[model samples]
Target chain A: MSTRTVDLVDYDDAVRRYDPVLGIEVHVELGTVTKMFCGAEVEFGGEPNTQVTPVSLGLPGALPVVNRTAVESAIKIGLALNCSIAESCRFARKNYFYPDNPKNFQTSQYDEPIAFDGYLDVELEDGTVFRVEIERAHMEEDAGKNTHVGGAGGRISGAEYSLVDYNRAGIPLVEIVTRPIEGVGERAPEIARAYVKTLRDIFRALDVSEARMERGNVRADVNLSLRATPESPLGTRTETKNVNSFRSVERAVRYEVSRQAALLDAGDAVVQETRHWHEDRGVTSSGRVKSDAEDYRYFPEPDLVPVAPARSWVESLRAAQPELPVERRRRLQGEWGYADAEMRDVVNADAIDIIEATVAAGSSPAGARKWWMGELARRAKSAEVELAELPVTPGQVAQLQGLVDSGRINDKLARQALEGVLAGEGDPEQVVVARGLEVVSDDGPLLEAIDAALAAQPDIAEKIRSGNLGPVGAIIGAVMKATRGQADAGRVRELVIERTSA
Target chain B: MSTISRDEVARVAALARIDLRPDELDRLAGELDVIVDSVAQVSAVATPDVPATSHPLPMTNVYREDVPVPALPVADVLAAAPDAQDGRFAVPQILGEE
Candidate 1:
């Protein structure tokens, strides 16, 4: 395992001495109900192999058939990435003998891919557009999961046995491989993160995949190599497998650059191998070496037919596309009449998705923004959780705003109800019922409170009758205090004016 | 065809996780040369106009609707495995090797 080397060159020194080249291969599991080549259902968590079909299990007589929605989703992803749609593609058997693959071969694309020569304009958080050139995005079937058990942390080493779940075996995947990304020295990590984030956003916008990195839907393999200079030939690269989050992607890139630079500096060559990214430890350990001699013996699958997408169908998919994120953000900013600073705050607070969903749930843009970016955001910050992971849903936020719009509660009470909902007090209405946080719209009780306030502050009430009405603030404040701030302030003002005028 | 070497064959065999005897490596080197030459003979005659065809038959748009179908029972699925435990297919722990 290289004995856990701590001699990593400084990041600035590493970039100065060597040019880092990045080749990111993103694997996205399609959200199709069925498996890629079989009738096995695709689910996130299922009991063992219960979702496995005979084709997924690689039974002798079982035949393979492709899922139509998976192909359409692949095409949509390609279109979103500005990739050229392939006229024809075929599945090839990637021969490997692992316990995870029941058939001992994965059906993947090799020479022919469904999408080729694409480029994605990845805009970093600083609004710099780095064009990451995509080599190809091809169709592949995912391997079954192997859970190594009986060891400390269930590591593969010292484990007594490993459990294999074939439920994900035949799930459809679009493996997007990028051409070697070069020349963005210190910003390499940021570029990598932004690129993946852009891909995730595009996937979600296209409604292709769930695109959850935590659930293994969208995974990125960071392939980084460091050369002495920009003109130097590419150094032997190490591929870090399945970095599952945006933060980890950036960290992996930076870690690889430093690690590889250290090896090169010490007169040791970086081995061309796959490395396992330990997210917990934040360090990559060496995996299998991708030797030139170790061939997968890729050949066309005999059971499945070739896929030749019609140009008309591809065009139709492009025409039916939803608004992508960048354009959508611009449209939203215009539609909501938000200034640049306002939009930036909304985006920075990570409130875009919640606000969008809240708006979709029948709340005004201003109302959604005020609730999500204001009170909910404050609570979410103090709670140290994401806005989406808050106890209250976007629907509840809209409901809370609806109560305010219907005069059931004013803004202040709505804030309390939102707080109550976030505290697991059920939805806004239930919170209103449980906490009794509502506006006192009844004039009878409000008038009685106003009369008491007037009784308490008769001198200020008399000053209002002679047209010096400034001291009426004490009467309104007194009434508000009596009603526990639930009395509508506007109504209290009008009632105080009426009681003083007589 | 490139001349195959015994050492190269041995290295490739090790990479493939196959234990090969010295004599068997020598025998496979000679056998693989013939196979490589035979495969090269066909490629020489095929013209560039013929695009590379991976599939045996030319077809397109072969897809099934995404729908629920009966999966094999867990017992049936686990029946073919070398080992099973807790309704899961079990294997010797992979010690970070092939």
Candidate 2:
């Protein structure tokens, strides 16, 4: 999180010497019920072998059936990103060696991704909107998860043995790539984070993948290079792999920018290779280099028939596109009457959907925002759960606020009831009833408690009688305490005033 | 099209992790040449205007609900693992500690 002042003298010389350009390829696992080309369940963290089918396991006689739902999800994502859908596409083999890939080769779309030539409008916090041009978004299968144990550093070296889970294998993935981005300059890191955040929102809006960074559902591979200025030929770029979160993406990019800049300043030519972003250390280490164009031995997948989606089908998909994240943010800002900062906070917290649902459940927009952005958000953080997953319902929230509005319960009591409801005690009203938390609106019991307090504290009562109305609050507090906060303090205060005065 | 040498075919097979016998490499080289030659028909028909297609079906704007669901059970996932321990898949030692 530290930034160094660029040695302008060195940078000036380097600028005359070199320029940096960047590109990013992001892979998002679609939240499909099944695998891309098989019926095996598309899930993460499963009992390793249970989800695999013959096709996903790459059985000798197995044939990929092409999950229709996964294809549709890919198309939706493509259109949401403002990409053009190709009328016809075919699957090709991407051959590679890795034990995690059961097939030893992946079935992917090479030249014919589902969508291409799109752009994503990413807005930084400073209101600078960068149009990241999309090169393509292609559909492919994910490899299994590998656990390299007993390695010297838990990497591929000195490993005694390795294990892999195929639960992630064959899961549908849409890799959205961006062309080398220029003019990002110093804003490179911010732009990187914002772009991925915006993409997460779009995925949520389009109902594609869950886009959970922690679970590796959506991952970013940041390609970074450093140059003196915008006008020079691009320098060699490094690819950082599997950055799972926006923060890491930004950090990785910024680190690479500095590292590469420093390297270039030292007159060292930047190496074109893959790097690993160690999130813990906030530095990138070397991975394998692509010395040559890897010949994947790609060819048409003979097992499955070629997909020939009709023009009408593509049109229908386009028509069915959901409101993209940018549009949704703008609309929600206007509809909720929230300031730009507040809306941005909601988006950053990933609570826009929850707030929207709460509003839809009859809560005032401002009220919904307040609760979600405040107590609910706090509770979600404490429990490590999403805001929407909290047990309290929107109707209950509105009903609790309604109780406060009608003076039937104080704010503190309402909060207590909320906790009760969140604990599965029931709705707001039910929690209030079950806990005997309703205010003593009748005032009879409150007056009796106030009298008892007065008898116990004669000097304080005399002070109240001597026109010290502030002391009346003492009696009100006593009465409320006696009645376990069920007595309305305001009404008790009024009774205490009248009695003390008389 | 360049003719694939037997040595080249063997190297590719090694990279792909498929063990091929010396005799098999030549046969594979011939077969690969034939396949590559046949598939090169794409180049003949492909014009600058003819876009290479990667997906068989034309699709755009497909989506699914973005809700996070439970990951598959660790036990279930590990059941398929060739090796596992302590609820995690175990693998061979990889890198020397820095």
Candidate 3:
């Protein structure tokens, strides 16, 4: 759209001589029962003040007590990532001043984190598995939430005042950082999204946290840059932050790539800064530039005791690792015989567990897949809810499938019954019974209806008698409509032929 | 350990906003200096073999459930607000004369 596109050859030449390097820092909130260093409840959306304790609120004379469960969870996360757990780790104070953090300084680990030098194997949508190297995974406490009012769109600028909710304060968070990933070039964004998705899968499998992006359980800070050649020093990078979804992450990276490439092609050097991704606009705007680490003065946290996890403790956590996401996905694909598209749909929807449960509840594999991927998915979309949160149980879904399998209900009627179940009317069988929507497979009633329709339309009856069975569908459709969708079409067709021959 | 002065202790406390008593500040400064100097031993022993552990477990890409579950009811969330108006948290006036 600019002059940069006009000089195609020059741009190609620049790209041929350049490479882009990427690094990412992701923060995931663990699903521990208590705060990171206190006994306050680790929950979202409670009565704001009810979740707070003295330690979480940073009350004077209140000392911090580390939650052993949080430490164990962090250790489990580290071990699952194949990191080396430190025998001894000390919490450091990262000093800052903001309304959200009541303590003024965040207690975190510096210079020595809890885990280091790990790697995650992430597979892209195209089936390319890339190993994203992990730099470190450190544990820290979450700050409280801030709501700025009277601003230009409730942001920092023009804000009249800010309010703080300390419920999230002192919550445990594990931040995982990635080393500089090279050679991705154009596929950098996809790789970033895949990496986050893979991480989310791992968390779910481990029962660590409900990594709902909307709830801010998992968030990513994507760093991107452009260079002149693979051997050249990497160009300056811009970090786009708080990208909460895979699609948004991928889009943010691609946007940055084109934006940076255009700037470089126009002879402008890219600025290294933190950028904010506007999901509504699909654009990035500059926020702040961190040129030095001196801004955050790091010191030891004196209020808490130093953590000295025993070697035996680390070993125990490692031994309890759950089945990894990639392996599970592969195994499920083979077991279900789902094509790539079908398998991807399940993975992307995060409906694998629900589908598996339905199958376990006695539904055929294909039938379970169909209902979850089709009707349930559509209902979830229209109602703005997740398939997992649907009111109908897996056993109910299997029962509904049974009705269809035994020719007791057609696909349309099954869908209607499913809707009723989702509306809390009752289970599928109950809905059918209460609404009198059971399939009319009795030949006598079907024959009466067929004879009445034939007597009214003698020409159509003659065509059916002459062996044209296609029009039978029209008659079947009418009969089913008259019966309020309670009649089985196949049995109605069999009765129609018998009446015509007589 | 070298003793810390009252002036230095006051400065750090003001920066950190603890509002400590004069005597307590003096005692804390001394103790902090000793503690910081002692803990600096980590820098000396830390080498390439001593990998820094951030998390104890080998958890690589852990994810949360992607489905958007319902948040706590708005009335419940706002009930804990220090001040509220029209189902939202209210705050004191912050703007000054333009």
Ranking by DockQ: 1, 2, 3
lDDT of 1 by residue, A1-502 (tens): 4555566888888988888899999999999999999888888889999999889988889888999999999999999988999998888888877888988789999888999998998877766788999999999989998888888778777787899998999999999999999887889999999889889889999999989878889999999999888999888889898899999999999889888888989999899999988888788888887745237877788888888999999999999999998888888889888888888788667677888888899888899999888887887788898888788898998999999999999998988888788788899999998898889988999999988877777787678878887987888888888988899888889888887777
> In terms of TM-score, which candidate is strongest?
1
**Model-by-model DockQ, in order:** 0.71, 0.21, 0.09
Worst ten-residue run, lDDT, model 1 chain A? A290-299
**How far is each candidate from the true structure, as Cα RMSD in Å?**
3.2, 5.7, 7.7
- Summarize candidate 2's per-residue lDDT along A1-502 as a digit string, tens digits: 1234432233334334445567888898888887776666665666656676666667678777677777888888888888988876767788876667778789988877879999998888867788999999988999877777664665666667776667778888899999998887667778888888888888888888888889888899999877666766677888998899889998887677767777766678878988888888788887777435465777766555555567787789888887777778889899989998898899888878878877887778887877888999999999999887889877788777777778788878888999899999988889898988888887677778888999998999999999977677677777878998887766777788889878
- Give the share of true interchain contacts found in each model: 0.87, 0.26, 0.08
Error of 3 at A319 (Å): 2.4
TM-score of 2: 0.83
Leading candidate by lDDT: 1
Task: Report the TM-score of the second chain of model 2 against its true counterpart.
Answer: 0.80
lDDT of 3 at A464: 93
Candidate 2 Cα misplacement greater than 4 A, ranges:
A1-20, A454-470, A500-502, B1-98
In terms of lDDT, which candidate is stronger, 1 or 2? 1
Candidate achieving higher lDDT, 2 or 3: 3
Score residue A271 of candidate 3 by CA lDDT: 87
| CAPRI grade of model 1 | medium
Give all TM-scores, in the order shown. Answer: 0.90, 0.83, 0.81
